[model samples]
Target: MTRVPAYFDAFLTAVAGGAEIDHVHLGHWDAPGAIGPARARAGFAQAQDRLSAALIAWLDLARGHLVLDVGCGFGGSLRTIRTCHPGVEVIGLNLDPRQLAVGFRRDRRRRNATWIAADACRLPFAGGMFDRLLCVEAAFHFASRRDFFAEAHRVLARDGVLVLSDIVLTRPPLPEEEVALLADGLEAAFGPWPDKWASLDAIGRDAEAAGFTLLVTDATANTEPSFHTIAPGRSDRPTSGDVLRELHRLGCLHYLYLRLDKR
Candidate 1:
């Protein structure tokens, strides 16, 4: 069976059960340079909040906007968005049912939030159904990000917006050995890697092919501090974070912020 998603879900479940797994995404630190995780728990939460705020800011949510969080993980962002825009309708779509279960078990007060088990590449929604789509640090596993882009294009309104933060190739092809190692690590942690990571330019082309116009792209260094992990697993153990840290250090991987408009 796939142990990767389970491992992550377990960590998040623990986070929901008062355990600290730091931040899931690379945080968007507002301060100057990277700060060590001296106060890891608080730092991680703060970083997560900052990144969520950054993503939410891009949505420009209104009272009636319908927003969907693809790969919604354990519903942290959903909770934050609901608080920020109480009048908006928020639904979360995830491939892992266990994650959704854990999310519901942890937070039972979401009167207006809905969670569904679904795949990102093949969204179970009608055309032009949502005004905004937000995906945070979870699209890398899609069998094909391009396909997800097309699906996002299909499900989003004509003037809809897509905001995504993900691990991407900042440079060309990973070394053969590194690719193998990284793939193995990711597969062990999440599931089989789809091997669909694309460069910034390639992603832009994919969006264009899917009938989207790029609105903004941010690759600031502020996200580096987010690498300071605090998951339930042993901090010293090599996990997906190790792979991300290595790829990022090698300048081959980046945490990218992209905002696209359906046209």
Candidate 2:
């Protein structure tokens, strides 16, 4: 198995508990609605399923359409497609063999689901083959978002849609300040972030340059309060989830969803 990247490993543990979650949204900015721990867990679980369903709905998938989930984690969303959109073929692509190995077990007895070890920006598929390409809170890690956008445009069939959720700075950065709310987060966490955060405007420009027309864009302001409720924490130091929640609270980043159609 390929070695997992440190930041991704940190993300898996702190954000998704290394489980079969659909997506590890960086921040849960919503207020915990006066609920108990057990109820909170249930609520967050439901919210995850809802988000997955919403993305699928945005895909507007039809039977026999080919779907590619770039950066698929444990194949959760691919399995969701297999269950909900029968006859649609779904492929889960990830660079990490460790992830692909675990994800392989998730697609048992399912002819519609397949997993591949590959790079997101350098997709191995033929041009104009896929009806949909999905990225669930996973694009930031790509080496070059522009390259990925170009590749996405090349691989999608005519009028195919690209639906993705991502974290972005509200706008272009001005003079910046850095502050730490906690000493440490998770078992291990990403070191001081390198200047990789991109604004929504930047991503939109990249998509447009790649011949995509924007169909929908919205911030996930109603993100569930999963940090305090679903994931464990400590007072001495923050979990990786805490670091992200703090960043979101500080307005450094926001979760957003976008749908762009191949033009």
For all candidates, the clash counts are 5, 0
**Cα lDDT tens digits for candidate 2, 1-263:** 22344766654565345454545543332444554456656677666666666777899999989999988877767888888888899899988876776677655765877789898878999999999998887776677778889999999999899998876644323434333223233123543222245667777898999999976545545563555553345668645566555555666656677798999
Residue pairs in candidate 2 whose N, alpha carbon or C atoms collide under 3 angstroms = none
For model 2, the superposed segments whose C-alpha errors exceed 4 Å read: 1-4, 7-39, 170-195, 229-233
Q: After best superposition, candidate 2 residue 52: deviation in angstroms?
A: 1.2
Compose the digit string of candidate 1's lDDT tens values, residues 1-263. 22235456566667667874433565777772747666444576777888888998988898988999998877888888888898898898888777777677756676778889888888999999999999998877777879999999999997999999877754336677867777676567655456545667788898999999986555557776655563323557755567666666777766678898999
- C-alpha displacement of 233 in model 1, angstroms? 14
Q: Write down the RMSD of all candidates, one decimal each.
A: 3.2, 4.3
Q: Which model scores highest in lDDT? A: 1
RMSD in angstroms, candidate 2? 4.3
Question: Ten consecutive residues with minimal summed lDDT in candidate 1?
Answer: 1-10
